[model samples]
Every structure is written in structure tokens, then in C-alpha cells.
Target: MSKICIVYHSGYGHTERLARAVERGAKSVEGTLVRTLSVDQVETHWSELDGADALIFGTPTYMGGVSAPFKAFLDSTGSRWASQAWKDKLAAGFTNSGSPSGDKFNTLVQLADVAAQHGMLWVSLGLLPRAPGPDGLELNRAGFFLGAGAQSPHGAPEVEAPPPQDLATGFALGARVARAAVRWKIAAGQPPTELATRA
Candidate 1:
């Protein structure tokens, strides 16, 4: 079975809700085991993270970048980077902000950089942005290709913000990462000669 872990930091409930949506999507894939870990809980979940076939990261974009807490979590993975413990693992990320263009792409770049530093493979959202319908809801509304991007109106409560459309986008990202991880696992088990032949 493929194992996927989602690690995120949610300053408010909005990002946490997105994380749950991602979790649900990852769980939708058969033969996949999913786990969600908040930044605060990472201290005790190192083993789980190390063992995951893929790691999906999520964070709130604060002041044009990743939140301080999420940065801290990324920094804490220094040892993993040093030992290349996460090498060859699949990595994906998602972020939420208050505006449509809150410099959120910078946050995704930072997340991808962390994954690169650990020698992991990065997964794109693999979704196309949709034009807003009459109801003003659409998948990949943010038009982000690096990773999933979500927006919550300023001052809006988590219960109503991010809307259903953004949540669906996050779900698509999760499922994509899980499916990629499964394929990666299968490929890793193949004999080098056979893999080369297929290539």
C-alpha cells in the first residue's frame, strides 16, 4: 500500500479546513493510507513522515509568504535534508490566502524548494483553471500550476470562506499526489533493467 502524509499549519480554521479536504481526497484512492499532521504535532510524528511515500504540504500565505510556523516546520527538517532521508519521495503543496493574488505563488515556490532540498520529486496540481460559472465557482480558480491555491475573503469566517470550489481543487491535488505516489512506488520496485527497457 502507498502511504501519504499531509503536513500543514493553519493560523485560523480556514487552512485547517482545506487540509481536511485534502485528506479526504487522498483517502479516496484505494490502497493508500493517509495521515494529516499539523506543524505543532510534527515533533512526535517524524517517523510517520519519514515513512510516507509522498508528503503533501499546506500552509497559510501570510504577508506574501508562508506563515512563520510553517517555515519553522520546514526548517526543522534540516536533519532529514542532511541525510537525504526523504530522497525519491513525492512532494506536493497547497496554500491559502485572503486575496486572489496575495503573492501566494511565492509560498508554493518555497515549499517546492524545501522538497527539492530533500531530493524529493515535486508534483504539480495537474489541473486546469476553469472560468467562473454563473454561480462564480470553479476548479483551480486561482490558476496555479505549481500547486493548489485557495482564497478566503478577508474577515470571512472559516465556516463559509474558501468556498466549495476551492475545497474541490484542494481535493484534486490530494488525489493527484496519492496516485503519483502509488505509481512511484511501483516503479521503485521494478528491476533497473526492466525499467530501462520500458523507458
Candidate 2:
């Protein structure tokens, strides 16, 4: 089976929601194992990453960059990088912030940089934005996104959220990573369906 690891840090509940949305997308694929961990938890069993076929990153953008906690987690992977343990592994990232343009893309670039340092293959969200307005009632329709560059405006308890289209975007991105990983494995002479099964 193929294993995908999602590692992230959410200062508030917002980023965590994004992580969950990403996971929802990843879990939709069959035969694929999805594991989630926080930056703090990753330090205990860093080797857990070795079993992963791909790594999906998540973090809230802060001060024009990724949150410090997530950066700390990325820094902890230096040992793995030196050993080339994650080389050629599939990688992807997602970010959230209060402002629409909080330089979230910079965080994605940083994520790619980290993957590159580890010699991992990074995946992009090939899915396009949903058209015809938000999905459903449009609650949280603007919050969820995949492949980085995501933002969610502050909302009240009674206020609407990012909307459904954004969440679907996240879901598609997760599926894209799984599919891409399958292709990568096939290119590496591995079985394409080794880790895909219906839920």
C-alpha cells in the first residue's frame, strides 16, 4: 500500500480545518494509507516519515510566511535530508491566513524548497477553481484550498465560511497527489494499484 503523511501546525483552529479538508480528499482514494501528525508530535518518531510515499504539508501563513511551528518541523527533517531518506518522495503543501494576500505563496515556495532539499518530487494541485458560485450554501466556501495559496476570511459563529467550492478544491488536490504518486510508482517499476482501494 502507498502511505501519505500529512504534517502540519495550526496556531488557531483555521489551519486545522484546512488539514482536515486535505485529509478528506486524500482518504477518498482507495488502497492509500493516510497518516496525520502535528509538528510537535513528529519529533518523537521522525522515522515514521520513512514509510511514506508522499508528504503533504499544511500550515497557516503568519507574518508573510509559514508559521514558526511548521518551520520548526521542517527544520527537524535535516537528518532525513542528509541521509536522502525522503529523496524522490512525492511532496505537496497547503497554507491558510487571515488576509487574502498574506504572502501564502511564499510559504508554498518554502515548502517546495524543503522538498527539494530532501530531493523529493513535489506535486501540484491540478484541479481548477469551482465555477457557478460556492458549493452548497457557500459556508466556508472561501476557506478551503489545495496546492497552497489559500486564504479564509474571519467569520462569526453565525457567519458563513469559505464555501463548498474551496473545500472541493482541497479534496481534488489530495486526490491529485495520490494519483500522481501512483504514476510515479509505476514509473519506478512498482504496481500502479498497489495502494488504491474504494472507501
Highest TM-score against the true fold, candidate: 1
Residue-level lDDT of model 1, residues 1-199, one tens digit each, is 9999999999877899899989998998998999999999999999999999999999999999999999999999998999999999999999999999899999999999999999999999898787453356688988999999999989756457688899988888899898898899998887899657899
Q: Can you give the lDDT of residue 110 in candidate 2?
A: 87
RMSDs, each prediction? 2.6, 6.3
Displacement of the residue 3 alpha carbon in candidate 1, Å? 0.4
Q: List the residue pairs that clash in candidate 1.
A: none
In candidate 1, which residue ranges exceed 4 Å CA deviation? 131-137, 195-199
Give the per-residue Cα lDDT of candidate 1 at 120: 96
Per-residue accuracy of model 2 over 97-180 as CA lDDT, tens digit each: 777777777788888889999999889766444333233423223342336455667665453333345555666667778777
**How large an RMSD does model 2 have?**
6.3
TM-score of 1: 0.93
Worst 10 residues of 2 by lDDT: 137-146
